[model samples]
Target: MKKLIILILVQVLFTLGFFSISNAQAPKKKQILLIGTFHFNNPGADAVKTDDFDVTTIAAQQELEKITNQIKKFNPNKIFVEWEYYDQKNLDSLYQLYIHNQYESYVEKNFKNKGNYDMYVQNEIFQLAFRAAKKTGLKQVNGMDYPLPMPFDTVMNAIHAAKQDDVMAEISAYTSGMAKEANLKRKTMGLTALIVDLNTEKARKINSGFYIKTLNRAGQTDNFGGAFSVAEWYKRNLYMYSIVQKQIQSSDQRAVILLGSGHVAIIKKFIEDEGLYEVVELKDIMKIK
Candidate 1:
C-alpha cells in the first residue's frame, strides 16, 4: 500500500510539471487593430457620399500626422489596406514609387485614367497605410480587398422582379434621408470630428442595427433583393477576413487593418469570433500618451 501511494504521487507530480512547462511554452496572443477610417480623398463613390474633404490642406495633414502617431503606438508588424487583392502588384509598385519619391510618375503612368491624381494621392491607403508602413520600416503593405459581383443595379433588378417597388422606394428614401443627414453633419463637424464620431461605440451599434435590419427586411419579398444584397455584403467581408487571416503567420504577428468605417462592425465581430486574435480598439490606443 505504501509503495502504491508513492507511485501515484510521483505520477501526479510528473503530470503537473509537464503541464507547467507546456503552458510556459505556449505562443503569445496576436493583436489585431481594426481602424475604421473615412476615405481621405472623399471620392463620393460610396452609397453615402460626403462632400469633398481635402486632406492635402496643411491643417488636414497635421491632423493626419497626429492620427498616424497614435497608430504607431500599436507597433503593428503588418498593415493591410482596402485595395483589391488582385491589384496588389499595382499597390506594390505605388509603394515603391512612394518610397523613392516617384509618386507623381507612378500616378501619371498607372492612375491618370482612373481619376484625379491629387485625390488618389491623398487616399487613406497612401496617406495612412503607406505612411504607417514607412514609419514602421515595413517593406510592403498588403491589399486584402475582394470585390464581389454585387452592384446597385443587380439588387434593384431583384427588387423589381419581386414587384416590391413600394418597398424599394420606401427603403431608398429612408436610406437617402439618412445619408443626407450624415453628409450634412460631416460638412458641419469637419473631417476629424466626423471620423471620431463614427468610430464611437454608438456608431458601431448603429451600423450593426442597420445590418440586422437589412437582413430581416431582405427576406420579406420572394424576389430576394434585400437577401441577396445583404448576402453579398456579408460574403465580401468574410472573404476579406479570410485574406487577412492568411497573412498572419504566427501568434507573434500584430496587424493593423485600414478599412472604411462601414466595415468595422462586421469585421470586428468576425475577428472576435475567430478566437485567435485580440482586437485592439483605436479608442484605447488613442488614450495612450
Candidate 2:
C-alpha cells in the first residue's frame, strides 16, 4: 500500500509540473508603440494643411535623427506605416531594396525632379519607419491603411436632406479656423516640439474634442449628417486597426505604428480595448528635453 501511494503521488507531481511548464510557455502580451506625427513633407492632402514645410533641410534632418533615436529606444520588432493596404507588396519590395542599401539611390533617381519632391517617396516611411526597421534588422514594415472612400458626399447629402447646410457651414468654419491657428503655432514652434506635443494626451483630447463636437452636431436623430460622419470615421479606423492586428504574429512581441496625428486617438482607443497589447506612449519613451 505504501509503494502504490508513492507511485500515485509521483504521477500527480508530474501532471502539475507539465501544466506549469505549459502555462509558463504561453505567448506574452504584445507591446505597441504608437507614434503620431505630422506629414514631414506637408502634402497638402489632408483635411487641414500645415502650409509647406521642407524636411530636406539640414536642420530638419538633424531633428529627424533625434526623433528616430527616441523611437529606437522602444526596440520594436516590427514596424507599421500608414500606406494603403493594396500597396503592401510594393512596400515590401521597397523594404527589401532598402535593407540592401539600394533604395535611396533608386528613390532619388526615380522620384526627384528639379523643383518637385514627392512626399510619397521620401516622407516618414523612409525617414522613420524604414530607418528604424533597418536599424533593428526587421526585414519588412507592415502597411495598415485601408484607404476607404471618404463619405463626404454622403455627409453633404445628409446635411442637405436635413436642411442643416448652415449648421455644417458653421462647424466647418470653426474647425478650419482652429486648425489654421494650430498650424500657425506649429510652424512657429518647429518640428520636434510639434511632434512631441501631438503625441501627448492633451493633443489626443484636442483631436477627440473636434470629432465629438462634430458628432454631436448630428443631433439625436438616426440619419443626421453627424451620425454618418461619425460612422465613416469610426469605420475607417476600425478597419485600419484590424489590419494592424493581422500583422501581429506570435513572434512579433513588440511593434510600432507610425501614422498621422489625427488617427492616433482612435487607434490607441482600439488597442486599449483589445487588451492584447500594451500601448507605449511616445511622450514617455521620447522624453524630449
Candidate 3:
C-alpha cells in the first residue's frame, strides 16, 4: 500500500511538470509597424509627371528621411516591399533585365518601356527603399505585386460594378481623410479626389435624376474608367498586406511595411479588423512623439 501511494504521487507530479513545459514553449505573437510613405513627393502629387508619373519632391525627400529615422528607431526584424510573386532568382533576373534594358523582352511587354516610359509610383518607391534597405541592412524586401491576370474588359466590368456600388467613393473618402491629416497633398490625393469629385456629381445625378436617361446613357459609355484606374492601387494594397502576413508567420521576426499612403491606410484597417495582430500606425506614433 505504501509503494502504490508513492507511485501515484510521482505520476501526478510528472503530469503537472509536462503541462508547465508545454505552456512555456508556446510561440509568442509579434507586433508590427505599418508605415505609409509619400515617396519624397507631397502626399497628393499624382499627376505631376503624366508621361512618367514622377512624384519626387522636396517634401517627399524630407518624408523619406523621417521614415528612415523611424525605421531605425523601430528596428523591425523583417521588411516587406512592393514586389511581384517571383522567386528571388526571377526577381534578380527582372532587376538585371531592367538594368540591361531587356525587361520588355519577356514580362510586361510594352506595358511601360523603361527608356520611353516615365517612372511612376513603383520606380519612385523602389529607388528610395532599395537604397535605404541596403544601407540599413534590412535585406528582406518581398515583392507583393500581381501581374493582373484578367482581361482589360473583365477588369473594366468589375470597376464598373464597383463604381455603381459606391466602392470607389468609399475608397476616395478614406484616402482624402488621410491626405487632409497629412496636410501635404500630391498626386495620391489628386487621383482619389478626382474619383471622389466625379462620383459626387454622379451620385447627385442619380439622386436628382436630372436628365436621368441621357446621364445614364453617357455614364454607361464612360463609366468604370475611373474605377479601373484605382483598382490596381486597391488590389496591390491587399496583396502587400497578405505577403506581409505570410512573412510574419514564416519567421519569428517583426516586419515593417513601407508602402504608398493609400496602401498603408487600407492595410492598417484590414489588419485591425483581423484582431490577430498588434499593429502600430506610424501616424499615431508620430503624434505621440
lDDT of 1 by residue, 1-289 (tens): 9999999999999999999999999977789888887777877777765566677778778877877787777778889999999899988988988878887676778778676775667788998888878777778899999988765676666666666666577667757876877778766775556666777778877776664564335434455666677778889999998998887776436899889887877898898888888888766676632
In the order shown, what is each candidate's alpha-carbon RMSD?
Answer: 4.5, 5.7, 11.1
| Residue pairs of candidate 2 with colliding backbone atoms | none
**lDDT (0 to 1) per candidate:** 0.77, 0.78, 0.51
For model 3 the local lDDT of residue 39 reads 43
TM-score of each: 0.81, 0.81, 0.48
TM-score of 1: 0.81
Position 173, candidate 2: lDDT: 81
Cα distance off (Å), candidate 3, residue 5 = 37
Instruction: List the lowest-lDDT window of 10 residues for candidate 2.
Output: 213-222
The candidate with the higher lDDT, 1 or 2, is 2
lDDT of 3: 0.51
Tell me the lDDT of model 1 at 75.
79
**Candidate achieving the largest lDDT:** 2
262 Cα displacement, candidate 2 (Å):
1.5
Clash totals, every prediction:
0, 0, 13
